[model samples]
Target: VWVRGALRFSKTPNGGEKLLAAASSHKCLIQLEDVAAESEREEVVARYFLKQGVQVIVYLGDITKQEADALVNAANEDLRHSGGVALALSKAAGPEVQRESSDLVRRDGKVATGDAVMTSGGKLKCKKLLHAVGPEKDKAGGRERELQVVQGDIIHEKTDVIVNSTGFKSEPAGVSKAILTAAGPPVQAELFNGQKHKFIYIHSGLLGCKEIVHVQTDQEAQATNKTCKKVLKLCESKGFTSAAFPAINTGTNFKKVEVDPNSVEYQDIAKGFHKTAKYKIHKIERVQNYHLWSGYFVMRRKMEMKNSAAELGEKYLYHGTSAESCHCIERDRFDRNYTGAHGASYGAGVYFAINASYSANSRYAKPDPAGLKRMYVARVLTGHHTLGDSSMKSPPQRGDDPSDKYDSLVDNLQSPSMYVIFHDDQAYPEYLITFI
Candidate 1:
């Protein structure tokens, strides 16, 4: 928790915007040894060398022009390299950066807020590039008023219940300490008043009309989804309209994920760490009718579109044929100009019924949103024999008879194993399975 690097760096007024600009623009080439020598003697250079971890070294410098083991690109949810660091890294690393980033997005869904991915660096000096989607940034003056993020001592929160993260030998640590200190000795006594299980929901007079939910974790480093879900369900069932959750994991685990507080990755991890708080809060909102915000707003939009398709009396994919298909129409006319209309699926290999919506585009098919239906190719898998020399680009050439080639292609298509491929971004949609 203590930033030893900051105190050593801040002792002298070495860091500022001006210094960073000058350091980056310096024409003189500095070698690794020279930088190292300087760091040993010069305090500023020493500051540049941040945390010397067991495996990783966190540094503060121009990421665009740094000699590192790997550089991370703060990517969009779709893993597109856009403006700022993303754009700079793109220009430095070239097209392969975007391609590899795309592949990761293709395999996995939109990179989660805290998830980190590694890809080839392309033209960059580093050995690899890490792509991660940071949490959505606060938009304009809207964020502060919304109060989605609350920072301070957890004990001070005047809510329905302040969630006490108690797990792995609970005496008093972190938020538990603050809560016990604030709420007189009676609250602690009430917590243990015949609490049989890990999840203890106790009514407390010390913390006013509120109560306390002391939850035991999975005893692992990270809190599981089940644990987080339990807390939320308890809040709704108990009718605690408002709840404040402290940081879940503190002293229990021997390991800690350390990152620079100012960095994008760190912020994302911090947001991820407190995801329980966000999840629990929203569940309470829906239960108490605190607000009319939907948890699945994006899906709701897709449902509206599906309803539009249903009204047109279009045949569902599974109705006549075993296959189902949907073209991603432009959500609005304004979205027509955009390319890279990626496609996704609801199921792993199959697109679920609900998956017909926007998020279903796993392949990121950049279809003309204006076009009602794009050309989807009928795919056939090679059965029994693998085409060792086949590229599937143009028909096999090299003195092969035309009739033989045609017969082979037909045979592959007719094979029982040769079924249609789903959620494949690389495979162009040459055959139309239309709803309209």
Candidate 2:
């Protein structure tokens, strides 16, 4: 009907003024306080009449000040009243309103896009607050782009594609493991069994998303960049409008160089090899590497600076591989893609042994045609590790928190003979030992 704000009747209207005058007696008028006298005398902007004999009036002013029955709040899915109109409404309604809104989301889950939920307006003029989640920009084929860095769990994001970073085998680890855990076992099964492509797509089962794009990445800047590009391309090809990615390859990168034979470092490394190796060392060639050794030192220094309770847990370990793989390791550093080349009893990672004899097994150090066996003396970062199993694709969480994870995995925590490192940069090949 005829709700009054600052209503002004038109004098030039043909019969509009006469009809409004006739219905003026039946109009329901609401007097708003502190309005300018001139504003009260302004002409009506526009009006529409429905078939049910009701008149709609349009008014422009502060929405929070309006004494409407319900106020619609443009809110995120979680109903966080942080900015813009949502913040203003929440401020006007007081903190209790936000608590009520959060309680609603917690009880009924997030409000989906194009849908809404209602909460009682605490101190606001409106009686009820309608929290509505709107569609993201570019979702409906718009050209504009929007980027946001949100600090929270990625699994809670509602996007067309959720990226899961893994090794070449597409086995879940780190963030990928968390994603798979949330997505349920079926998604993990499909991830392993599905045909290999540039990227693997698994249905998001229990996850609050549409699909999961598992991309293989190693602890290298180049690999991270390549993974990002592939993910974008995959999303484009699949016609997905939105995707979520966690911090991929958040580890150091290393380069290998041949160490000078006359250097003192070389003699010390050779002496250590002579002390540890069970087999007779035919030769010990020191290699200059900046990743695992330097990375371990950096982590140790950082821990000391922060005065963290955990120790760095640095250990000199040995890894045995075939001649071809040895060359690859020397060239490009340890690649987690070949994680299970020998065995993955501890975990799917680059395995190292505290005892050289353990790694010197024929199964690991495959003999060449000339019967020469090769092993690497690597400085491994085994910071706060725990016992791991064959099923583990990554180190388990430190405690109940998923974000805080162990730096490495071991066969035994008390006396770890074997250490498994998921991140490639966590270990560096310092010396190459050739023995019969």
Candidate 3:
């Protein structure tokens, strides 16, 4: 991209207007015609004009102030709007921006690399001031050591080059050219290693009632870790090397536990799989913490319905008495705190179970630190077990009692030496699955 100048103007005789018009027309420079003002030239005044998509111009004696939609402040790691650019922005705007910035700082420990915070530009001409933290200024002593360690890792990882600059910088290393990009299905397949696994797609009642859809389930639901182990046995029987899984029956099936997709349940399962199986555990998720709970509440409205015999039976059997109601009858303390405490307990339970001792070789649940990761993975598989499947072909169905379901996957392993492949995603070479 380059800039091309058009024609220049004279220094006399109504030349300013003519030059301005000419400049606008040809995207040329507008200049004073002459020092000797002609009668028509006196009428020609330089009125302040701003145009869209036009380069700014300043006359020889004009003083210009930078006009921008907003100003950015370089804040400290603590997000304090203090000193240097921070002070400048604070003075321009009101103290409110600083206060908001401080609040945000308190909320998220230190601002990390490539992170930013926004605040209202109280009295400033700008609408907002975005606070950004640059890399740590102190790059000596310990900083150098840390940088060297990080640089060594990057180099060891076969990175081509490292670029450094103040302000804006660009690198020639195109992410698109990488051997594998951590996005879309290819990455997923690579992580999972073609592990034929199943997941229970459990939609919350709230999600089912919403006009705007929210939740989507995977394959099936397992009542406990036993179900997970059973599914792995099935996968092994089918000659699958590995599989990616989620907390099965626990999420939607188990009431009273608010199942966050990213809770400890998922984490424990991933870690367990990584620990026990010779496979990669690709945990695909996003951080949607508060939104899930809030959205659940917002979609809690009930719909009118005509009763059928089956519906009547369901109502009579499950919800006939207040004590036995299966549906979310009323917004109680449980619903209010489900997202935080209630959900957290369930997440913790799964985390504990996965982290607890287990013996995969013997297909038993014990407090074996060595087998915790495997147990967690087994738990995730349990989530995939379906109730309708026959026991002769499939592992036992998930029951309310978790102990019975424990280690079912290991017990049902078709071969003692079956291989486990940890694929990062599904698109990893299918040949890898065959190798397993």
Candidate 4:
């Protein structure tokens, strides 16, 4: 049995007061309304679990003022405690609560959705504060759409569509294999029997979903964004509202492999430098080959940058600097504060050169006491660039729209020899080479 509104003190013909008095003896779980303001008076809004021994009571009041042993705050994954109930709770609990939440994220990374991290309640009445990250609505999709992060098998999810990441032929591998196995033989037969396409939609035979979307994974990072947009468009066309997708290409798709000196990878890099080296070679020095790791944060920023740019136009470029600066760049990454160190001819940003000889000049690459010059072979994202001048600090607006801005600036649009990016993360130092 369920009850609504506050229990009255006056006796009723149905013996409601007797039932309410009996409920007072049992242990009750009090849940405060999330929308309630701090100044609101406490009142019983609803009740459940009448048949069971447990009593579930919903009260209209501020969660921070509750005398419960613990209080739960709806929080983001980062636990910034800057908005909504999180902000209110943080204010009531004191500064230590926010500080501890930040420290927790730094130590253990961001808390996953549907997971909760505990912290001291500080000045609050509760002894502990549980920061719970909940599923958020997909704002990009629509107000009616929600985005949830769930664990367990995707094949078991009951949705309109299930996305499977696979090769062109849809060979059974990784998540694709598991999905096909659960979907039964008909799905596999349709995938192999049909003409090869980038995306193939097939009927879900045994799987819980109504349909399956097989996406051919690409090596380029930009492909991820493109595939998502394509999938959403397809879903909209098909009138499908819900879909479940496995974490695509989050595994060994992109790995940092050390380029062996004898391997073709090393030779190709060496050839690039030698072909563009205007100065005559005196003596060849050491070339240390190390592939930069693309961690989670880096990949996330890359995707965002790719989506903003008209054309990703990624290229292998060179950056020359001192030995001390090289060490700092490797450890701390590129710093925009040091922009214009060589000269902001294009813009006040980190500059990269298509020709290694340009960066090899002493003006940019300072010689160490040992007489060796250092340079870096970096992966630069020269996206949707236009010719720039010293007056500009950032990329200019792409067109009439102020919100739309160019990703980077170039020396020349038709044939860009130099690229300047205001964003530090736009360029990653992949290989550092030392020479005479």
Best candidate, lDDT: 4
Q: Please provide, for model 2 over 1-436, each residue's C-alpha lDDT reduced to its tens digit, 9 standing for 90 to 100.
A: 4334334333244545554565587684444333355454435568999999999877655667778899889998888887788988988887677777766776889888999888998888888988888996666666654556674457657798898777756345555665676676688778777776657778887676778888766677887888888888787888787889986443223334455544434555555666666677666776643333334344444443333535766678988888888766865678877545667777788889887887788888889999999888887767777888889988888778897788888887677778888876667677788888
lDDT of 2 at 312: 66
Q: Which stretches of candidate 1 lie over 4 Å from their true place?
A: 1-62, 139-436
Model 4 regions more than 4 Å off? 1-259, 278-310
TM-score of 4: 0.39
lDDT of 2 at 229: 80
Error of 2 at 21 (Å): 99
Worst 10 residues of 3 by lDDT: 426-435
Candidate 1 clash total? 21
Off by over 4 Å in 3: 1-28, 31-65, 140-436
Candidate 3's displacement at residue 131, Å, is: 1.0
lDDT of 4: 0.73
Query: What lDDT score belongs to each candidate, Candidate 1 first?
Result: 0.43, 0.72, 0.31, 0.73
Q: What's the residue-level lDDT of 294 in candidate 3?
A: 28
Q: For model 3, what is the C-alpha lDDT against the true structure?
A: 0.31
lDDT of 3 at 70: 59
